[model samples]
Target: MVNIVENIRKQIDDAVRNSVSKAVEAGELPEFEIEEVTVEIPKEKSHGDFSTNIAMQTARMAKKAPRQIAEIIVKNMDLEGTYIEKVEIAGPGFINFYLNNNWLYDSLKDIQRLREEYGRIDVGGGQKVMVEFVSANPTGPLHMGNARGGALGDCIASVLERAGYDVTREFYVNDAGNQIEKFGISLEARYLQLLKGEDAVEFPEDGYHGEDIIEHMKNYIEEHGDKLLDVDSSERRKALVEYALPKNVERIKKALEEYGVTFDVWFSEQSLYDSGEIEETLEYLKEKGYTREEDGALWFKATLFGAEKDEVIVRNNGVPTYFLADIAYHRNKFLKRNYDRVINLWGADHHGHVFRMKCGVEAFGIDPDKLDIVIFQLVRLYRNGEIARMSKRTGKSISLTDLLEEVGRDAARFFFNTKASGNHLDFDLDLAVKQSNENPVYYVQYAHARICSMLKVLESEGIKVPDVDEVNVSLLDKEEEIELLKKLAQYPEEIRLTAETLEPSRLTRYVYDVAAAFHSFYNACRVKGEEEEIMNARLILVDSTKIVIRNVLELLSINAPDKM
Candidate 1:
């Protein structure tokens, strides 16, 4: 849980604060309250390791030119017991601080001490978080949208766990809804069509047309025979639904498990109605005056909570709407389960639903702000420079299973996570399966494999990796060596920031950077033939990189192979 970079940043800020306080106390500058002093890492290395614009911030209150204030601050600065080697005023009032390599050495020590736990941080303060994703209808096969959402949601949960939140991965099963009704109708139609002629029963125009529906009925006929044919359509459809729903749910679970995702809760939508939570939620909303009747339908006053218009919670037919069930589901999440925060990963098609859902949660006497909905744009599959709409195996829409079969689970997860959720993703089939460095996942895994090979060779040569303290880390003065250490130092801070932003894609980008740094270091600095102390330090550095790279891959649920 040690963040050496943040520790150094705090020390730098403290030093600057002390310098400002001393100048004010000595009456060399007018007294003024400092609200916040920001210490930032400079993008350009030569500008210094850390930089602050404290003087510029104080210019108005000090009634002096920024450069003059900077001079006074620098003259009063005390650098004792700080990692700062020197401080300089650059470009009008920016105070640039150059540090001794001690902080870098300290980062190495932290990594060795914490090992796999190095990147962990406690920024979340043990808040309960539930991430619900990929609650695709249990009708047919899960499509590419579910695949992307699964990877993003699962990785986000992992990041939150590392950042110190009690995280739950949930999949809301739409087992009871209009979709299920349609599923039953579709299965009945397919079943009857198999026993009778295809033209004997008319398939509903809106019924599911996927081959899975046909297969489900075909299997049902084999197991149960044609007894269902004598029953009324309603009784037969109900029986067909009872038989097929479990299989569909099981298939969904198996597909997700194969894709490296497992849910803490497979929350069923029917549970809300069965447990009376939906009825209770409606009554609660009515008590809050958020519900009213219009056009013979029970309407929620969505406009009261910033929605563009009111929405129907219950139709005139007296059955609850999906919107109503969804509100109750969120109510169950907040009031019954009592999660401190709930995040939903949805497709961009749910854009309008987001506003009403937030309003619904707010009406449930909970803070709607705690409900975060990230609408990720859909993923389009491309193979050989053409859009791939049909799966070769399923002969229908490309499913999560099909994607896993073609690109591999590791590549699919890695590629899906390469972009932020807010952006559209074009998943390139050719690039994902590439074995060379052109593939990002292969490049990253190869870095790990390369290190494993190096470590093995060194071990066989009787050159073991020494402890961090046993080597003189100052021997790591080469540019590549320092760059690699600097990147290692960033992991902890990166974890914290990614958690704050709720963006798991940052972790992917970070590991890729670490891989690049390691590759650059491998090419420039020879770890084997160096003098004893330098070789030992580089060996420890390389080993530390392997740990971090593997840790990140594990978090993303992608395998880190010892050999690629």
Candidate 2:
């Protein structure tokens, strides 16, 4: 809740506005109304700590050159009771403010006082949000795509929660649809081939060909041999589906949980059908004149909602398409569950479905802007400096379980989130498992561990981290110490930005920066061997750094080890 950087930025903004007001009152400048003030961190260190373009923004209104206006504002500025150490006019009309180390000193106190809650901010205002991701089909194991989506979605949900949203992490179970039907066919054919003979039945070309399908049938035969051989094929397929679907769903659940993601809702796609919501949605669309019959099939006029053409909601055989089911599912999310916002994490293959789904939600009287779809690109796993297409265990596309087994939960999640969701990811298995600083997760975790080890050593020597009031934090004015404090102060702002952008990759980069700063501070300033007062001040700084690193790692669901 305590954002030191935001607090300082607001202070700077107010001081700048007041200076302009004072200038206007003194008749040194024309009287003009100021609507807003903008303040931001300077990209270069020489440009000062914070910069604003108020002079440029008000030039046309003030009827004066921007540089003249900037000089007048600086002359009238009062630096007392503020962190502004010096003000400079740079590059045409930009006003930059250099700060004393007060903000950095205050940040250490805030971190110590807030502890684990240091980075939390109330940007969401308790609005209800549902993040649905990794809704893989129940017929097969989760692949590399699911791995990336799981990490990104789960971390995003965590970021939202930290930003004070009432967030629900959900996994939509695609347990019913064309894929389930194909699953039944695959299981039935595999069952017959194992019992009757391979030549007795032909596997459908569109059926699933994963080894898990064959394993499911073999397990079923081992438990109950040929019990469905005499039954009708329809009944046999239903029995097989009933026996295998739950296991597959359960496997998916276990894999996700192992990958450090637990869904609050495992919403089943079949629930919409069984609850009659699908039928009701179709009827509602028909009543609204959005539907028509074409070639004996019921079609929804998708072009009205910006689609390329009309779409079939129900086929001529009376079976509903997945599109209809999807509409009903979103209707349930918005109208029934009453979430203020819903986010879906999907693979890039679903890019074309994004706008249509938004259109569908709009037809239900829901604001389409509330529906956010994050389409992440594919991930290609690499091992031994080569693309790894097959898992050593399954000899198939590498599963999430296989990825977890190969590197680890921390490395996998960290590496998957190292890039923006829009960029294609080449997961380096070799780099992920490395123990050196080349591995980012290792580097960050080592920073935390190094601090912990240092603290333990000092604790044995009867030198504990002192309270904020116990030491002079002004002693932490060294270059490396100031840079580390600046990084620590940016945590709350980082959380706010991550929530706004719905990007967990920001935190990954941020924590690495914090680690880098800590490493720099560790080498430049000696915490253990310094003078008593300086050592305690550095101890407090180091302790605060540990808290921030752990906080970010916890948000990403990665562990911070006490030893590396």
Candidate 3:
């Protein structure tokens, strides 16, 4: 369906064309531009529906007062087949139109006709886009910080799919990093402690200290037997360390899925190693003169591409750094998969690393514009005014699994969507559990379920959902009823605007507003058996509200249960 804004613009265009033709025919001013007309929502809803600066823009050219131009434009205006209730020049010649309720009733009819597919458009036109997110190293179960990325990435993928993009969700496993090695050693110490019944653990102070490591150790002992514990060589040790990667990744994957975060691809860091892509990337960078020898290791002169200083790509031991593998990984995403675009969802701490990746992307011959990096600021979780900062390595960061256990997937998604990505979020568990007041997620969900309850009650009485378009929408003229239709009519514009800004928080706020509008309409009117035409129209409006609320909640990856 055409968006209401565009539809209104067409009406304005027709009016302007007639007005301009009259002026040209009368020779008021030799040829004037009629291109500056605009129709945008007014701040004060009571003033008018949408205000346009077209009259003011044309006043200077027409050599008339802005009011005079507005009068001429209004005189030529035709509201036939449109919803324009009134057009007024107010506050220094601003032309504002008040829309009649019919505009909204029509949108409600379309919503009933479209159902799940309402508010949808083919804006992407079938572009292939890959989203790589929550690619946290497989050193342990997802931490609370990782949970934020998981929820965000999953939500982004959902929205893209709705926007008609061919979306692929990817999780990059950095199993070949220093962090993984530390994780394996931590498991080894736990293995020894469990085998020999030794009380003291040989794990380093900086290694993972979570109790889950003990479980991993017991499983390894059960599988590998006692001989595996006393392996003494560095080569065998690294082999055993690499052996634990799958186990760690399995734990991470389970936690994410349980939290309602799903990925289509698990792109391994070892693949970059296995395919010699890291070596090829370094050599390619060398060809670009971005590599140099520093401190007996090869470094990428990232400063040339706006880094604070050069970064080592490979150590003296000939092992490439994590960053090299990341570059190699992204290189394949564009070159091999041939994705039209790549979106990297990284934590705030990785902000400094974005420049070099962009630099490396350029050096690899792919346009840097194609690689989009979204850096989410750090998340500070709280459980009832007290901060939750339990870490696995330091025992100071909250476990992601535990967070999911405390809050269901719906609440977790709501928690993440509560704040803007750029702002630091204090995800309070207590707030998430609250049923009412300021908790936007539950608030919207409650509204959805209430309507379902009302529908079921009506259903029991043999009332079926009406074909609203078949009904006479002209009967729906009550103030609150008209208000809902207006809100319903704005869905297309809302979706486009949210996608344009890449701001899901826009929907977060919008869901509450939509719910409030529906609630107001519900309480102020009684439509059990009154005018069948208006009854069907109101039902359609309610149905569309439910559908849009669900769409918005789904975009945030929050469940829109018919029962809260």
For candidate 3, lDDT tens digit of each residue in 1-564? 456666776776676677667766766544787766677788898678878887788777888888877777777666676667788888778888887766676677677778777777656678888989898877666776688777777777776777677989999887777887787677777777788876755667888887667776677678777777556746545655666767778888888878878889998888788889888888888887888997789988877776678888899899888778877888898888899988888899988888889877776778988888878888887866988676334554577877766667888877786677777888887788777857777778989998888888888988777776477777778888777777777777777676555556666777788888888988898768777666776676677788888877767767888786
Considering only N, C-alpha and C atoms within 3 Å, which residue pairs clash in candidate 3?
Answer: 389-396, 389-397, 390-396, 390-397, 390-398, 391-396, 391-397
Q: Name the TM-score of candidate 2.
A: 0.95
Best by lDDT: 2
lDDT of 2 by residue, 1-564 (tens): 787777878888788888888988899888888888888888999999999899999999999999999999899888899888999999898999999999888888989999999999888999999999999988898999999999999999999999999999998998888898899999999999999999999999989998899999999999999999999988999999999999999999999999999999999999998999999999999999889998899998888888898888899999999999999999999999999999999999999989889988988889999999999999988989899988777677889999898899999999999999999999999899999999999999999999999999989989899998888999988889999999999999999889989888999999999999999999999987778999989999999999999999999999999997
Better of 1 and 2 by lDDT: 2
* Per-residue accuracy of model 1 over 377-433 as CA lDDT, tens digit each: 989999889999988776777889988998999999999999999999999999999
Better of 2 and 3 by TM-score: 2
lDDT (C-alpha, whole model) for all candidates: 0.91, 0.93, 0.77
Which regions of candidate 1 are displaced past 4 Å? 28-33, 53-72
Where's the lowest-lDDT run of ten residues in candidate 3?
388-397
Cα lDDT, model 2, residue 436 = 98
The whole-model C-alpha lDDT of candidate 3 against the native structure comes to 0.77
